[model samples]
Target chain A: MQTKIQELRKERKITQSELADAVNVTRQTIISLENGRYNASLILAHKIAQFFGVTIEDIFIFNEEEENL
Target chain B: MRGLFCGTTARNNEEYRKVVKRRMLTMTILIIVGIATAVTAYMAFHHSTSAISDHTLGIYSGVGFGMAASGLFFLIRDFLLLRNEAKLKQQRLEQTDERLAQIRDLALKPALFTMLFILFTSCLIGSIFYPVLIYILLITVWAFLIVYIIATRYYSRKM
Candidate 1:
């Protein structure tokens, strides 16, 4: 899964720490997500989406076709 | 005046540096003391002369062992403190991290399986050579397995 978190966060001029605080996650979690090293849980995904005022689908790009491959 | 001379960041940095320095000093002193005591114990144990009275030899051995024991305690205490401090620091830095939770989940099955495999295999192997020891080990392993299973189930349900 990929996400527009870094792009959106940058556009919003928000620091990773501020985003993490908004989503109730650690800064390391945000770093891992941006680096594509970790996938967020459903609750965390929801929280992140909510914090950005966007739908989860808008933020997270689910690659079902690639997964099938 | 204090705030004018030193901001919050500077004060915090200074306090942190002081704490780290104190910890390093204490650990260094403990290591030196532990080494000295252990060396004294080794010398006393090996260098006793025939001219020394038996009672005096006993007292010397006792004192040496006591010092060595205290030294061992200090070393072990410092080790545990260092490990615990690292863990606490990580926890504080990653207070809401779900990755830590995931890491625990990832580790659980393999650790449990490995422990079970080692205990069961060792018990079976010992049964071939030492029947009495095997029986005791088997009982101990079963007790441990039961406790582990119950605890796992309880935590699974709770979590």
Candidate 2:
């Protein structure tokens, strides 16, 4: 999953720690989600999307692979 | 991993895996402890009860030594593994409050169970193998249940 969290946060001049606090998650979680190391739950993803004034689909793109499994 | 049941925040299986691993370790330790306790009862203190000081002391020593060894084993294992597990958990802590609370409860129940088991054994294992142990076991069960209920009520209220 690719998230627009870093782009949105940077546009708003928000630090990862600040974003994490606002979203009620650890900064490490935010870092991981932004770096594509982890996926966020629906609630967290929704909150991030809302904060960025974007649709969930806009903020996060989930991709299905060919024979990757 | 991505397709795992996603129940809001409960969908995250990493914490579940970690908790299950801890539980498995605890259960394995408990089984070993139980077997050692049984063996210690049958052999160390029973047949030739005179070689040891007192029959009661012999039984107590068996359980005590078993518990001591078990505690030492887990402490050593936990000391080595807890730091790494905790660190990974830190890196992945998007945990919901409910799941976090459940994890805390899971960690505590094992210790509580161990404490109660030891207490019961030390106080009343003499009646073991005989019908007299039935009463002691019943009383211990009731006592533990009542305590657990009271404790749960208090903590629930606090929460």
Candidate with the greatest lDDT versus the true structure: 1
Q: Compared with the true structure, what per-residue lDDT tens digits does model 2 show for residues B89-157? A: 443344443333344556677877897788678557566556677687788789878998999999999
- Model 2 has an lDDT value of 0.65
* Model 1 clashing residue pairs (backbone): none
Q: Candidate 1, residues B1-159: lDDT per residue as tens digits?
A: 111111111122234344444545665665566556556555655685535555665665666566556656655654554556544333333433566556656776787789778877887888888788677777887898799899999999999
Global lDDT of each candidate: 0.67, 0.65
TM-score of each model, in listed order: 0.51, 0.36
DockQ score of each predicted structure, in the order shown: 0.35, 0.14
Clashes of 2: 0
In candidate 1, how many clashes are counted? 0
Q: Which lDDT tens digits does candidate 2 get at residues A1-69?
A: 788888888888999877875665677677778888777778778888887788999888778672254
In model 2, the Cα lDDT at residue B33 comes to 79
Native contacts present in candidate 1, fraction: 0.50
User: Taking chain A of candidate 1, what TM-score results?
Assistant: 0.91
Which residues of candidate 2, in runs, are more than 4 Å off? A64-69, B1-159
